[model samples]
Target: MTSSSRRVVVAINPAASFGLGSEVGPALVTTLRGLGHEVTSLTEPDFAQLLDATRAALREKPDALVVGGGDGMVNLGVTALEGTRIPLGIVPSGTGNDMARGLSIPIGDTEAAITALTAALHRPPRVIDAGRIAFDGGRARFACILAAGFDALVNERANRMRWPRGRSRYTIALLIELARLRPIEYRLTLDGVEHVERALLVAVANNLSFGGGMKVAPDASLDDGLFDVVLVRPLGRLAFLRIYPRVFAGTHVTDSRVVVHRAREVRIEAAGVVAYADGERIAPLPVDIHMQEGSLRVLA
Candidate 1:
């Protein structure tokens, strides 16, 4: 599509980022319209409803679909647009905006992001990798990251907290969970290697960060066509306390107790483990994950 004919659709999650979606939606739409592009704003919808909206938007053949919520919303929108030529745009307004941060998209200023989106619309779309998770009956999806074990527990707690939002809430939740957290035994087949461990957390990442800003897989690249597997081995509370802070700076991988590896696919099985994909609980035990290389086109 030509730049002048470009149409932009913004999917807003009013409940995301402590309810900033309502406040940000109109402003973003106004800005984009002022730039001479057609714009549409959509309120938060369930996954199926959201998919329908995306598919309808695709029929219109918009130049870009600007995702205006957090990581989960972004994942939903991207899942609908995957394998198509539609270039995805993002305006980070969610609790963890980790995917936006990874792509260097602006977070705070709506006007600046509008400008960036407008410019990005004129450029060629870049293809990136997305992660997929499968279970017995069906499959779940993720665009940025996924985690199993303690980190998933932290996510559950953070979702329940009411006071703080974004990274602050995540930190508080982590501290709360750490006091009583226990490691779990799991058997995993990564790429072709098999091993078992009592793991505190096992993170499989397509992008580098998750849980607001924690660098779960520091060396992970979106276009690398591989998943970065991060295993946090069982450690004492004191040791975990000392190591947790380093994840923020992307230096936790240097620790001897932490194990990081690259693989095209991973198979995980646990007795009573819950798994999370992009912060949403999808399944429990016996999960399979694989990387989809250059499957998503983003306006980055």
Candidate 2:
């Protein structure tokens, strides 16, 4: 899999890394070029244009596509390279590097992360599953988690606020959302079997973590041909507050109110609820999702 001169396309979210970390994009490009790779670096003003530029670059059939950002950028990669054999590489420089964490790629340290990308390029790309989301307007792919519940609300709220940058924004959002928390009623069909449940949130996870290192589905696997359907039943504010901190260590899954199920295909419905996958707002439920085995090839 190693090449003396590989072509790489790098698309970065300029807003990534809280505005200070955009330098990682140029760092990656420089390092990649130093390694004897032909790199096409693209930095766009917004997500749509970034995705469009990435797609256009991907159309060139480069040796690889390296995106410098968080899981949202990973989502862009899957959307652009869906059904293609091209392997995607990640250079984490965002608020929540859950995707990179799940793949064991270094975070924060640009040098270490780029080193990992370079090493992965020299070996056979790892094959992983992607969750394909089908909602009104369109269908997209998620390489990490797709959640609809209280967490998604927090995501929406956080996106609206501009103060207190970095992970603290999400923390503040979570606190604000928790103050107004109410269990959502959900009708879920897993592998064609249906059930109704009331819970704080329902997360369909392909990777292990989300919302920054919260191991929402600690037992989940990226390559598994199934999704871990996690349901957190209604809890009092006190209980929820206590359990929230445990999610970082992934111990929240063991709580009695928490339940996990496995399915290859899922249909989730909750009136007035919006879903977010890989930290990007997807759509209002109900959305149909299924695990596509080995759908994505990643340079991890």
Off by over 4 Å in 1: 1-3, 16-19, 44-48, 157-176
Model 1 lDDT-worst window of ten: 14-23
Per-residue alpha-carbon lDDT of model 2 for 1-300, expressed as tens digits?
A: 244778889888757645757689889999998888999989888999888888888889998999888888888988998979999999998878899999999988989999999989878999999988999999888989999999899988998899988679988999999999999999999999998999998999999999789999999998879999999999999999999899999999889999999999999999989999998899999899978899899998
Please name the candidate that would achieve the greatest lDDT relative to the true structure. Answer: 2
Q: Could you give candidate 1's per-residue lDDT for residues 121-169 as a string of tens digits?
A: 8889878888878998888778788788888887777877897956799
RMSD of 1: 2.7
lDDT for model 2: 0.90
